[model samples]
Target: MSGMTPDTPARPEILAPAGDTPSFLAALAAGADAVYVGLKHFSARMEAENFGIGELTRLTELAHEEGRRVYVAMNTLIKPGETGAAWRLAARLARRVEPDGLIIQDPGLIDIARQAGFTGALALSTLANVTHPLALEEARRLGASRVILPRELSIDEIRAMGAACPEGLDLELFVQGALCYCVSGRCYWSSYMGGKSGLRGRCVQPCRRVYSELARQGGRPQGKDAPRRKGAPHGRQGEGRPPQGRAPLAKAGGKAGRFFSCRDLELGPLVKTLLDVPHLASWKIEGRKKGPHYVYHTVTAYRLLRDHPGDPAARKTAQDILELALGRPGVKARFLPQSPEEAASPDKQTSSGFLAGKIRITPEGGCELKPHLELLPGDYLRVGVEDERWHATLPVTRRVPKAGTLRLRLAKHATPKAGTPVYLIDRREPELQRLLGEWRKRLDALKEPPAQDTAPPAGGPRLPKPVKPRPRPDMLLTSGLGRGKEEGNRAAGSTPGRRAVPALWLSPRTAELSRTLVGRTAWWLPPVVWPEEEAALSRMIDRLWRQGARHFVCNSPWQRAFFPQRLPEDADLLAGPFCNIANAAALAVLAGQGFAAAFVSPELSRDDALALPAQSPLPLGAVVSGFWPVGISRFGQAALKPNEPFMSPKGEVFWTRRYGGTLWIYPAWPLDLSGQRREMQDAGYSFFARMEETPPQGLPELRREGLFNWNGALL
Candidate 1:
């Protein structure tokens, strides 16, 4: 089937980030086909100056006048009770403002969007991490017009995804900006360390901090004052000096300071390679948190390159704008090779090194050349053919003898001469003559090869025709215990044939609770703060699994990681919001690592949501309701213990200092659950629910009224 129809536009829309009025105006002026922003409750960017009804209406009007579109971000995970509120809000927006699309991370919101009579398109956010073909298909089945592929994928992977994607499903990519190391944008390090939940749109980037790694020998702590190990060279040091003054280091074997900081990714030099990808529909720029100047500069530069390919003047303009906006020395294609310091430093200097042949290192400490002209002892070298030139020294060290060739090594770094015919350096005239003659003979032989027959030989085992691989199932459903105050009511019942609820219930160590529920269900009970107590609760889950429990849920990656793997083969594996799969590549990696399902971020667009289901190799689950936690982390054991509720000295409702930025939390007031239900149903989702909070007493009535359904099963 053809991937595009007459109705499908030849060129994909240019989607831009607009955090406020100024950024919105800049995006329109610079040539953005569409802009995405957020509302107060469900938006992942809590710190952004989000729009209420008035602002959204005004922005939509302005964008329409410029022949541009606007998408609202309502992508935060909703807790159980919050589902209705989230739905209500979405319905109100769709009815009133009528954006071209709604970017959503949760299936519940998708359901609400559709129920509220929203006929516009949907884009899946990167937070959905739609990486596999199955995920994309699922999203397409539901109603996503496009899916934004993860930023971490290599060009080869992107090609594969594009080839497998169904017709009418467009692919988007992040061409520039801060690249997250974590998979699929799902991170919990901030929540664990600073109490900010990235899934709830409040992420205190703990990844940027430096922390000493505790050395464990045979799973035992080595000793006090054990040399601290660093997670990355760029992370922050210590507990960020606390809030008041420098506090004495805790006796917790703290050694290495901060470690994991990385500079943002700049791909101006590699735009040619990016454009070569035939399936790429959109090139995204990261920096919703940044200002208009940065957005304008980056967008304009890329616009020129897209319009005029291979134009030296156009490429030069992009480089200049990038340098000024980044406020650094310049840009560079990272991962292309260089010194260890160059690879690690957050500050990158512009270099055309990626265009050079892949750098190969030998045991003799020399770099090897591939697919490029052979270098002799001395050669002049330069990095870029255009502007932002970077020169280096090159010297040959040794040459190894092969059958009829020499392997030359560089003694010092040097740039290769561009746009040149072959240049031969000869120490001995007779040897050079012989070498040239031999090379010419080999080239002549390669140029003219023996001809082949016109047709293939008939059968002879028929080569056992390769079978076309079947697309893997994208969504899977499993059973778990339901939460409530009732205790062991099933055990007291006399009827032996009564079907019990299939589920796993985690009770507080002090509260003796037991039950069985068929199908996956989770309780958002307050977490147990003590490690020993948490361990005991884990043991109870083990015991319950033996009693027929099939699925379990935890709030932190560490908690899920530590859970004992004793369940049956039919058990379902889910990475809670704490796991934070922020990009499509991360989701693909996670699926390969064996997660059956994941809770998507609320920051994704409707197109993103549709694309995720279509691309994912596993089922995509959505968190619909309850109180959403703002900041959380997966890097360490530090958990943000809220000292107060929605009121802090920082003049914010909820704030956590985990990663580099301060994550602010807010409460969502949903407008229509019915609309969210329809959207999810259209997305081909087999499951949907509000995970963390209590459902309203009228939820059952709402469900009966066609408000919620999981794989056609009424809630």
Candidate 2:
């Protein structure tokens, strides 16, 4: 009864992105099998001009009429207070827009969506961090109908994941789009910088900011607080002078560059390789913030490659079509492990759009450019990188011939240096504009969706049966520290009313170190588990299980698969801080998945973190003290040496360290919530976590002072 024989495989759908009406029409025109859009709120791409519920309802009907599918991205993290609103929105969407699926990041949204009457598919967003092959099973168990694989995965790794995908669940891979410097779901830079949490989709792109490495002596960084030997002379904090002979790293900063901005991922012709991956249901193109021109061209190019993988002529044509898409310089971006191209080039500008020409500032504070390509009326040009603060994008009101000088209106404060490059980011040619106009007219003529009751169904979500709360002691997250020392310390502090429990970081050497009392200690799995490390981690989990290690904390939700399906009755599992558990709904989802307790995201404000336990279905905890990382990446910047402190323009100190298959960028100072421990415990939090990270040698010991986002809102 099936449509295909054993020899011929079904074609994977070409999923396109649409941020506005024009882009949506462009995708439909380009023959995209499906289109994905975001609502005005609760979307990962909050910067995009997302759709309203009524507008999305009309778009979904139009897409359905064209034999295409529409998916809504309600992927932003839900805060404690926003949980009810999120559920109501889901209920409204299920009744009104009726999208084919809802791509989401929060695990807690799963059951709530179902209880809210949403029966459509639920695709796990890449922000969910389903990175390894073993995670596929866990994703399925967590109610993901499809998993969007991370962009950092190699083709071979993707195939492995594809092979392991559970029946009835599918995989989607990014074939073309922007690449992030940090792994998805792991970045906390923007949140740490202020309170714009990337997990909540308000990222201000702190990673794109220019950073300069501090001057290093003997490969050891000397910050302002670099301790001087008892006899050595050093200047006081208020003094501007460096410590005697040693130059201050921050004051004598290295050349500044956009050290973490990554080039966009473009697999123009290379998408053919993905055809061999089984269970790959869709080829996703990422650009909700992009334009109609980009949407059309990219959709067309991927369709061409998919339909004619064996034809060289079609591949050439596809590549040519992608050239017109004014995206950032394309990179394979770790797709080919053997000959992979680096995603970030610190020496090169990582701005999107093609280079048009260089600008020269005039004496009158005006700007002039001799265009390399003929400038058309209505074309948009970006003046410079946003990191420079003066970056601006403007539309061309008049045409300018190639190599002809055209005066650019100045903003007075936008002081772009002479020879600064200008980029042709978008254009509205006559034909495309005409098409968009026609589509807009048709869309406007469509009747608006009928108003519906926005309230959630009576009695709210049919939440999963609550798991009995378990009493957990305060936890200490440590690495390389033997269990003997931990037990010794605990024994010495026996007089404490609530002593900290030791949770050993599960490494390859953990088996050897936890030979005795392994059952008493909880094993903490790494947040990131690369493809190569999965088998070893799984084996280590089994080894530890046999050694009576019944307590475990999974930093990533998918890490649960490393444990055997059959567990002892006394075994306990807790979702770790890196899981980004912010709301009560997410806790219910974790509880349903067998987690005994969870640590609320460290990025949560005191108000958000404290308000959670009352609404939660399981016991809650918090990371009261630790060196929380700003970001984690698979590729390290060659221009900046690892473990050496780098200074942002704002004077924040950051450094990177290679751990396993990934690189983690951490702040110089740790996040200390020791002052808030009593407040947290008083607010129903069962435990507090203190991360014990060994700082690199010679790094300055700045007094730990930050409360993370506890005092302020996590935007």
Candidate 3:
């Protein structure tokens, strides 16, 4: 019996975020129903000060004492060999702490959990791609207790999911956090830019940087290899240059600002509306990398709203406290249009952060910036040029007319031109900081220290028996290339390996070379095909079909109809990862649409992948080697420095590449799981390691060993 009844809707539980001990304590004290924290390693926020494995029992005790729950985030992708280790740890933690839930991103955890006899709840992390009703159904089949919806989904889409949610399944929505412009788990930008793999939780957020776009007149984009300056404004949009004869300087963002830097998703206004939607299990706030003060202010505000929803005065107080705690303006409620115009920060920056108002250059060339909403003394504000090439940070020292405006008095430095945007970035006002301190002090007075569990819970569940290794090595290995030289080599050369390499995954741009290798290899179409390129792709497939090609892969779900529904009995239609298929139901649905086999989401763990085959042999495809792409983005304008690596402030370098007119960023190291052959074979998977792209002159090139999840390192 849960809290809700048929007659009355249950208030959505407030799930707070915790990176370290202080944050966790603050959230619990602030009235959170549950808190989500990361273990020191294998966490998505590897940069945060996560709890040690030893701290789990103590933390669980502390939360449980307050009638609250704890959720451990073991959400990083696990490789085949690494599955056993992760499961063993998870099982041990379960028996010790008995956490409310384990939030997981990988499908392989299913097998591991079964083996460990672990019975704890499993919440599907947003990375698992539980986007549609079909996906929600699939997650339940795989035993997910809850599905965290992707932030990109609209209010209408969320309502539909709620309607379609089956009994016993819960839906979680992200209420506040920094937003990623690209869909979570689907992006490869950080990885392709260098070697920092987002999937492995070491994302160097290149998404936050200042990137300028370049374009010729009439909507033509510059080539990937084009030379440009790092700070030069783009040519030819609405900002400076004209459209036709001249190179029109494009505004990186016109009134819209940074298009790729999405504003935070704050649903303050829609809290009541969402509560009534029904089946929204919890409202989650994402900030494991944030400080304790952020947790305190956010948790307390939400707690106030949840408890006193009917009081207008309470609502006003919550909003005022929220503004005081978060100096940033612009908390976007989802009811607004889901367009870049609405979602992107006006500065085209990662954050507008706090809400300071627009600036007006005084008649004397000095600037007067009025606070747009609320402002406290000692609050820090930034005044910069519209392009952000130059800016200065100043403290709010003086006020005029008590109208929430700050006057800028600079000594002969560059004053930002008139109408420049002002931002409240630092929320370090003395009163706000003291309030946080008081909150923590009061919480300490009311709570006792955590009690540690010295031993694991007795009589852990039985581990499942290991099935015999069932290997299917005959599945054809394939080479996918978008470059011409690679296409020509595939056409002219012998099978890539001494053993037969019988398949090809090719881009449509290489259609001319298809005639040479058409019937010789199974043609698997490119996984990512844009709309404008559909005609060319269809023509290429038709040409290959006429030449006796029998197999093709549909990268997107929409392509299920694009490929023929009826093919020869021996021919194959394969589902791609972009289709977001992670469960048997999605695959079964695809069966009617001509898909004979399917590629499991690469995010699936070895054990999870194995569980699927045990239920039904669907010829699931797995990529065992190759550099995993971390970002696939259309925001492709930028000038390159030497080597063109996406450098992080921490000094890690990720390499970026452009193909099919889109930018790709990959992790510095390739995911070399060649050593995990047993994991794949045991799971009943057909393995494919990406081979050389330029066509192998001799044997197919093998990837060198690199940092992979095989051993569960640093966990």
Candidate 4:
């Protein structure tokens, strides 16, 4: 049975954002059950007023006093030599501030949290981009207490995820906030385009900027043929610019550039559907960058909605508050299923974008957007009907204006029902069907057949055959890292009867090193490289597999595209930190894709991580020790000069501003690895150390006691 009793009220937690003390207090007073905040280093929001040790202690105490929990955000990617410091800091904070949990994004930090003696739980950051059950199980193995589902999942997807997860894992979802067009917490476009690393908490959002381009045959603009327009006089080039007074371009291809902005996500109306998902522990509100008024109004609205779900007046009150917070403009569900016509394009004007779920259109022309609230009469609704997109309005009328909720104007003969969806009367059904058929055919042609080449090319090295293991007990102990020569000698002298540790994780550059230990225990851990080098990685993995290695770790989803034909059937494909497995549904998807194990992101809460293994379908491998790179992106490439550090003129540095050019910094301290091992043991998972560095002086022996204290200071 779970920890909660039958009599305990099934009150879903109200998790709020606190960029600083003021917002923290406001959220707590507004009835937030838990509050999440960031530190000076490793948080995604480089501009938020973050807390230091002193402020964090006070904030934690204050929240605990009000029966609220505090979750400190250390959710950023760690640079080289930075993991040790970040781990120590997490341990120190866990000891001093006694926060309910730590939200993290790096696996190395997860080890630091364990090593520092932090007894608090771990929560995975959304940046982990975890979308599968195997990923969740891996997180559970890594000592996560809770998992924050990605903001892109739909209600049906959430339900399926909840049903698939191992029991006892708690799930959290974002019910409000600005919707990110890039995958939640994994975007590096800002850093790639600008110099700011989103993983390191500094992001110059280039995605929001406007650019000019030449007209193309289709709706898109042609990149090379486009002529450059001079910056507006006295206006910035990439920053906000004054509108050039000009007539809108004709519908035919034109020279104007396409806008790449996405709208915020508002799910105020789908409160009931969200509440129905079992094992859901919290309903979150986004926007640490928003104002106090936005926080107060939005929090109050959701609180009322959750408490009085069935009350019509209460629902209306929530909607009113939401509209006020949203600035009362148009909103749309992003990521949810939509016909091409129903889908909001990059050019369409709206306050929000795609929502993940099913949308149904009523005969009365009123479209009911599920899992998304904040709908009003006179609101223009888009729907995917019969595989084609169409626009309609609530309360069908003979005539309509372009925008806004004006007074209803219906024809004398029209008596539209309240629930029926009213579509524009002029749509041609046959034309839409024909168009959809052609589109499907075009998509089908893109699919490729498997490569016919199985053997290595001439002059290439010969492939090694798989080795059979010697008979022993069914129980196998696999230490994730290989002992150094000296350490191996010491171990050999100390324990003659001990079983040899198998499965050493090798870096990308050390592929040649694996040849020295061929036919022995070994696995490849691919480093994050440029998109152009992905084919090279695929070739390398394929070569390694044929040469005897079967286990592997991929750093990101983009790398998955390279292995389309070469994914090993028997190999243990451990989803790396970049996979960001935060929920059971994500884990399920990974399992379907043939992953044998996975690494949980450090950003998850301890409770969420613990639940992951129970809810997942594969073996969990906890990140016990290592300096896992937190910010892995092509953005770092942009800053590289022939001999200079990669820096961005438009980008802001995360922690230290004065330093320029490809700035790399460490976390405040190391994670407590021992603590995580114990936690994973308790959760029924076999733990392994991901040692990116030599085990500290006392650490190797401490592995036996399962108690090690590594103190490195924070940035």
Q: Please name the candidate that would achieve the greatest TM-score relative to the true structure.
A: 2
- lDDT value for model 1: 0.46
- Badly placed stretches (over 4 Å) of model 1 are 1-11, 213-258, 276-279, 327-715
Candidate 4 per-residue C-alpha lDDT over 53-79 given as tens digits, one digit per residue, 9 for 90 to 100: 666776677677668888888887654
Candidate 4 ranges beyond 4 A from true positions: 1-8, 215-258, 326-715
Using lDDT as the measure, name the better of candidate 1 and candidate 2: 2
Task: Report lDDT (CA) for all predictions.
Answer: 0.46, 0.80, 0.57, 0.48
**Which digits, one per residue and each the tens of the lDDT, describe model 2 over residues 68-160?**
999999898888888678887888888888989999999888887988888999999989998998888888887778888999998889988
- In the range 309-396, model 3's lDDT, one tens digit per residue, is 8888878877766664542344553444354234545364445455466778776767787666555555566676323436677776
In candidate 4, where is summed lDDT lowest over 10 consecutive residues? 231-240
**TM-score per candidate, chains pooled:** 0.48, 0.92, 0.60, 0.49
Better model by lDDT: candidate 2 vs candidate 4: 2
Give the clash count for model 4: 89
lDDT string for model 1 (335-452, tens) is 2323112212322322222232444455665544442544433232233222212333343344322222333333353423332111121121233335434433433433221134
Pick out the ten consecutive residues of candidate 3 with the lowest summed lDDT: 233-242
Identify the candidate with maximal lDDT: 2
How close is each model in CA RMSD to the real structure?
A: 23.0, 4.7, 11.4, 23.6
Q: Which lDDT value does model 3 have at 91?
A: 70
